[model samples]
Target chain A: MYKGYVVDKALLDKDPHFKAGCILCHAGNDGELSKEKAHLRMLKKPSDNLRSCGVCHKKTAANYAKSLHYTTIGQRTGVMPRFSEAELKTFDEKVFEKSCRSCHASCGDCHVKGAPVGGISIGLVAKHKFVKKDEGKTCAFCHGGRVYPEYTGDYGGAPDVHYQKGMLCMDCHKKAEFHGDGTAYKSKNEVPQRPACKSCHPQGKEAKKETQVAHSLHDGKVSCYGCHSGSAYRNCNDCHGGHAAAGPGMILGRSPRDRKVLTTLRLIPTVRDTFAPAGIKMEHFDAVPNYWDTPAHNIKKRTERTRKCDVCHVDRKNFLTKETLIKNGAKANEELIFVPKAIAR
Target chain B: MKNRRTFLLAFLAVWILALYGAAVFAATPNKCIQCHTNDALMKSLHKPPVLPKSEGEG
Candidate 1:
């Protein structure tokens, strides 16, 4: 009698979840013939509690529990470095769980329901149907602020050539990567199922030798994005929670994560003193610079920078300079400023 | 007899027109049904062909 609990006849007969009836995952008063009685205690997103999914997908549940999506460790690492020892303790014990960890995804978030992003939770993804993959709804919903938009040309610039060929996210990102092959990887880098440009376009086969020779000139100093990221990309400087204004442009910076001396740049939000509530005083607020080794997804076969070597070799203005840093209000970003000049390199 | 024949012919014409109209309406499938019961869309997207059981029996 519950309007939301419309049973599919084929699903009821064929599927095991329905074979046990809706009560197994969604605990409600299904026995009562009356609509009011049957609707009592109905669970909308059963995977949120994890009791239902864990009963079936124990291994995957255990793995996903430790995933970056679940832990949000990157954000913690970025923010916690600036906190004093005492401040870190307070953040870890009290604030981290509620403030930071609330951004994490439960099992239901991707598969069955919308995730909380930009401070809003969306409705059921497929009207309570369990979808295996819905890139537009699931992945884009979470990563929409950056990667997903760039991939589809929604942010600006031409879409990733891959998407033009009708290649969806799952085409490259296989099931094992999403399902967490029982690995509790800290970052995306450690995931064995993680994809690289070389995985699909090997150096000799798809990437011609001429490209390799040109790549060698950089001496592994610059990221592929340094040359190949076409047009400008959306970047935000002073992101205070969900409210950050973005502009389309490019910057070059050294990475803290991999120590890549030259890399395609992005603005660092959550810098020192960000998201610290009214009363909580931070002693070493500016202790760490949060400039990350970013994989800017605004990719193309050739970019304005890559078209001519002299564009980067001769051009000092395009590189992230003291003036540019001051203009972007990122002069305080000491980690990014110390990179060797493009001309000298 | 002539009047009777004319009445029967009119009734037959109305019946044919009604059948044709019903057929035309039925040709355009319901939007909700088109998505909810669309097997091809589900299969192409690699959404589960059948929902799995609680016991891992899909």
Candidate 2:
């Protein structure tokens, strides 16, 4: 009922929660009393570390320790970065945490996630399952330019498909590719993801026959992603082999060794059960709760229910067996067995 | 007959030189150290390999 300033003491006093505090995060005396110490003290509050975060988060802390946020605020101004290294002075550590992570978390506040074992009760609603949502918003919120510099026009700027569409960082950068240990480069290099052409069409083979690469040879060695994952493609030397094209590129991909399945498709199922933390060895995002197969696709079916060999190897007349493909020049031992033949120097 | 004899001798000489050159390039570290006392190339090898850039580049 109080419409103007300085007239709400009696009205808001009816509520116990509202009447007990001056601010949500800050509490102290009036401003006319104790210098600027209240504001300065509010700025220096330490972030609440979860009871279990450090038991597993030391290495990241080390990397972030050397970062600028730790150097400046964690040491100098005494504030911890709330978000991640993608927001602020991302060129360095300190600014990135202070500007990006801290801005989202401290100001944005608490998050909730699904419990590994417990059911969702009414008691858990305060913590919305929004850590990734908050992180994605932190990236595109203000300074999304570090990744997308052409943000001036309407056609581009963090992709129009992502803006307020409930889309996230993983949705585009790597929707289908598994995010194991959150890095694609360092994991056991087995079963390289056959990047799905899903977004380019509908999921699977109702997909229009989009022409990508016309390989002269339908050999097992060539793959769609072996050539195109970046803005520009380096020579074969940079990826499959060392920076010297003198040798065959390292076939880091591991298919089942003892089997004789030819070039159509393969799956190396992760040993862990789906309920466990280690369930996904490949880090696939759309993880079926109990499924363990990492489906390496050479094709997607017409109905798309079964993603198999025909998506690429449609020339049914020339389906070569494993031995036949080897005779046609797929390397004899391509599991990276040799030390790259000493680089042929 | 004379031309055939010359061709055989020429082939023999080429084979001998090529085989010997392979053995020399595969020389052990001790033998290489005898000539390369400064050890500059050996030291450089331990670093992550960089391609020998053409001139006027980093």
Candidate 3:
């Protein structure tokens, strides 16, 4: 009746989710009066199997099974470049399956209840009610460390313009992005319908001539976040043996994915010795840069760079340099360093 | 008159049996909720939080 296991009696008759009785999803001896007997074979998270919800939601369950959120293949793709064939095999068995894949979200995690992060849960989301979407309770728990906090401005500076306009994660990131479009994408970058600034704010649509000129000038040269990132976002450092340290920073640099484009970047936590604990020396450590281009969640309408062009073209502030790079990082990180040119007056 | 009396008696018997079945179905409580709804029972059953094996990505 209190926290984790409370079920509203009123919803028992009203909601179809409960009509089949708890035993249908959560297998247990409902006939037994003794507490221990009744809970003997009960499933703590029935949705972990997906079939529990799949019985009624066939299409969603089938698509979700291949979704990045459910499969968590993106984590493996990000780190695979650093590993050799044999090392990757070892990593898949030892680290990825045992650790990363455990983080995948199940049906109940978002709908019926909040997922258990770090073995702690918020319990039933609304007295066991099956909600369509509840970003605050569901998304916030997993992304609380960075994205959510950055979006809400709870980490440091003002909240994102989107958040100020009363938008949640699902507002921009559509349900199909979470539910999957029947493609087993290796990484989120390959997701076709993933949220992009250009999707909402197309170029040349700006009412102000100055804004239109700025967009036109920076079309392919600069990324939206390069100038719009409002404040310092979290940069994770040195993750080894499943532990990582994080710090706030605003790093502007050449995109690792495309050096021609300048954008906001964040320091990845992987280091040479990051996998050494698991006996992986990372034979190809330099293959991937330590700093990867990030779509910083803390976006603003006007930032220091937007207000004064001199901030970037003249002073070249926040631009990554060899001197500012993390010590003992991969040599590839040097490639991400970019220097801005002076503006023509 | 005899046939009419027999039909009435059969109708009453079937109705009584249906009511009995409905009562029995309604009385069968969901055992999961029976214990979970008890505040004191749940409080007593609560265990200490388990330590996480690893800190996952955000």
Candidate 4:
């Protein structure tokens, strides 16, 4: 590192203390650079490595714990019962050489200032040429056909390029915003200054004012989840719900037709059901101490918690604006919102 | 009868040890104060560092 061999001379002068060497992220110092010693570094468990980096990103690691990645491992007591360790070890030997570069892709490779053969150039970044077949390759490794399914009869799935070619998970999965143990609190407004939805749909305000364009426009009311994630929309269901949000939104026995009336599924405190309401059924909108004990965060009871609406009377301030409202046609006032931060990010 | 009672006690001890091992092993909460007491965790999880009220809202 002191020799400052391939590192840019100008860049090094600017940031003198920059630890620019393999030893920073990897192990084995003596400059031997043996393949066996490099692989020995893998013996250090992921959790231990996480502790080293957790100091820099305290909040992000906590949220990652609650996410699907950690949750899957946690549920099985850190064991994949279906696949034996021996079988996986054998499979690793057969297919690993061809697949390792793609499936277990790391951030170090992508974010490195300048790499060789696959350096951080605009062309390489644009095409995501780092991993030959990136998304399908990584997701399918652990997640079966349901995810990046190469099988037939998996009809209602998005085309692979959406996850593969498009802005992949790394683009949006905010670092230092998740916990290692895997529990993401809803309080984290990704863009507290702005919002998440408006990032992709900047002209959403104009869209909300029109009947045809606005997804929120239902019979006469707005499906807030279609806009701000209310009702059936809960947690991180907005983007990941490629299929109909079948997790929390699965109403006990209600059929399709009954959905409209039973739409407001209040999380009324209940005995731990055999299936749903696995743990404590705390209200969605947790109390902001000293403010009020109003039950917020529930699908059916959000607007009442967040905003005062002209549900019965005409909001004279918004007649010209609220004209687009399908249900509250009488309401003269209305406002629209989206995840506004994506624009700035 | 004496032998059966001794066996039962040994089994109970093993069972209790296993349960405690699982619970404590799963939730390993370490304190950063070991090396650096001043960290963001202290701010987020620790009691607020504000002066106690004296008289009232003066």
Candidate 5:
């Protein structure tokens, strides 16, 4: 049997997904003997159109249709602030619809086969089995660019504490997060079911008195990633049209979403000329900062900052400053620069 | 002898009908799997993945 296309003949009688025959979802001539005649107009990825899965899994399919993974509307929301009314219209038509929307994940991408990233795919998740969850193949393939690599320490220093404990993407991020609760949320931040560090590790639950004191002191002022980001994470620079060169570095700055809170920030590749190829000038380029708060995946039980308060309060290590800021970045970037005050003994 | 002959003819008819029913109405081997499961055929069709020139970070 072939590696990817091998289907266990035994499953034909057992699995209901296959009971209706391959023709039920993958529309093709099952009666045709020749390969050429059989695959004529076959839906290579039947679940691309949710109706294939929605026919059986009504609720999950209906919810997944509106999920951030499916709609990918967060991409548009991220840069919408920088566009003028006419520019927004142009971006919607040219850049977003053409480039960004293609990244949306379909139902089959996770359950049946791995989604193609940059035009390369792993073909099938298993031997054509409808797996409940295969984060290593599915999540790792799509998020491999940044998050997954960092989580596993392939991109940098020690692997995340959670990975060391054998936790995966689905551990914290539950099924409801992937299959929406019937809300057409524009950004993932708006999703009520999104994973938060505090959800699992509550503040007052620290084992040691020292740890408990630290958590209380920085509870609202600092984000968990601000101190726990293990090492340098990837930062993209100078994105033009749809391409950007990535580098390794970690930047701690005020959260662009909530400036009062300090958090791990990643440089967004959007520059003034980012949409120029599509004839967009991004008239209000200074409206949004180039850095955005990112929950860095390379978390550790003990980091340089966590080990010593001096890394932040005294040395102010990894903090974003005006000089370290990207040249030709938006003027709004200046607002994100923050200096941690020294602790008084 | 006539009774025995009649019984023999009925059995022959039943056997033939069963064979015809099995050929026409029984489950056919899934043609999709027939070619897909052939390793040699898939290997012959395999080509190196071509990376797209697009600006996707993932």
Candidate 6:
């Protein structure tokens, strides 16, 4: 390793980037042989600035600038629908920048260095060599806490069939979604390239006729994860104050975006004093549950609810209600409590 | 005494040469503009997004 950066022989000998030399990307004095002087203004991650990557990949950089990964607009918009106009302005200017923005992925954060999340920065993603993508170290490094673990069955549930079949995030989520198609969408829902369960599993393609009929009953109303997600998933609470005060749990509720849809509800770490640093306190702290319409990654082809029709249809106890919520702050999440309606089928 | 003086001068010359050799023989120019000034390279270097500009002191 040269000064903590592993010198990849292949990259040094073959890659154009290495041929261009280190000083081209990492700025500093090449004339000085002293380590300190050579690294005076060296950029550990040059790709953090679009200019570094844009020189060769202009179109991708242009589209990526507007992508959700860059702007984190989807996360910003998710909370917008819950707050008032006055609160939103303060949130945009203060709370978001202080608390949420750091977690948002930058281009270099993925393709070059490890993401800086919760103030923890891992080593370089690929030892200063620019990579197109490395899902394990790059994507999982940030998403490791919840999504990655659940996808791999590390969270005590059966792994997603897709993951078992060796499908990476890039497999389902195409390049357009990552680099963006030049549309500034407010949420992932608004993106035209957003992945849907229906996209891969179309009607009557592989599913049985009975399964199609059952899906149709709740078409456009419920997400497939509502019933198909078999195991308990992450629903964090009280993040601003204490880190240990949170753990994963399952909760069901009406989708915040679509009221009629009963979907899997995960409590985002937005609490009363969530933005106390910015001097903004959420007024309706307990008025509504901070349940966002979450796409729970833990999915099973056959689940408790899908094992048989009557398990969900007749079992009122299993449904989300005051009795079923096990966590401490769950009672406050009144809005997301699933209610049973008469099934016409 | 003459031999000692010759040894000292030789050591000094070697030290200076070792320090300056790598920089002088570097394949790429030490100047930033030498490579960055290339139109093809510069054109590809696109401008970054206008992120929320704040004091970041918050």
Which candidate's lDDT is highest? Answer: 3
- The runs of at least 3 residues in candidate 3 whose Cα sits more than 4 Å from the true structure, single-residue gaps closed, are B1-23, B38-41, B52-57
DockQ of each: 0.01, 0.00, 0.39, 0.01, 0.35, 0.04
Report the number of the highest-DockQ candidate: 3
For candidate 1, write residues A1-345 as lDDT tens digits: 121223244554555655555667767665564444655886756787655788988888877777777777756766665667877888877777866677777888878777756444455566566778778878887778777888899887788888888988888888777767665676677778877776876554645777777776765688777777776776765565445456877777776665556777677665434545533455555454445666777778887776676676676435766666633232345667544445644
DockQ of 5: 0.35
Deviation of model 5 at A124, angstroms:
0.9
Ranking by DockQ: 3, 5, 6, 1, 4, 2
**Model 6: how far is A282 from its true place, Å?**
2.0
TM-score of each: 0.75, 0.25, 0.92, 0.28, 0.92, 0.79
Ranked by TM-score, the better of candidates 4 and 6 is: 6
- Misplaced by over 4 Å in model 4 are A1-48, A55-144, A147-167, A170-345, B1-58
i-RMS for every candidate (Å) is 16.4, 35.2, 2.7, 24.0, 3.1, 13.0
In terms of docking quality, model 3 is acceptable
Ranking by lDDT: 3, 5, 6, 1, 4, 2
Write model 3 residue lDDT over B1-58, tens digit each, in one string: 9999999999999999999998997889888888766667777877768676756556
Each model's fraction of native contacts: 0.00, 0.00, 0.50, 0.00, 0.58, 0.03
Task: Summarize candidate 4's per-residue lDDT along A1-345 as a digit string, tens digits.
Answer: 111112332342354223343234344432333434444643322222344335555654455545433333222221122224553444345433332222222232223211211111111221112232233234333333122231211323223332343544444444433233344332332223222334654444543344335334332242232222122211111121122212222111111122232122211111112112122221221221101111112222133212432321233221112232223111111222111111121
Off by over 4 Å in 1: A1-10, A32-36, A118-122, A181-183, A206-209, A241-243, A326-332, A338-345, B1-58
Candidate rank order under TM-score: 3, 5, 6, 1, 4, 2
- Model 6 chain B TM at 0.42
User: In model 3, what is the error at residue A151, expressed in angstroms?
Assistant: 0.6
What TM-score quantifies how close candidate 1 is to the native fold?
0.75
Assign candidate 4 its CAPRI class: incorrect
lDDT per residue (tens digit) for residues A84-116 in model 3: 999998899888998788789999889988887
- The 10-residue segment of model 2 chain A with minimum total lDDT is A232-241
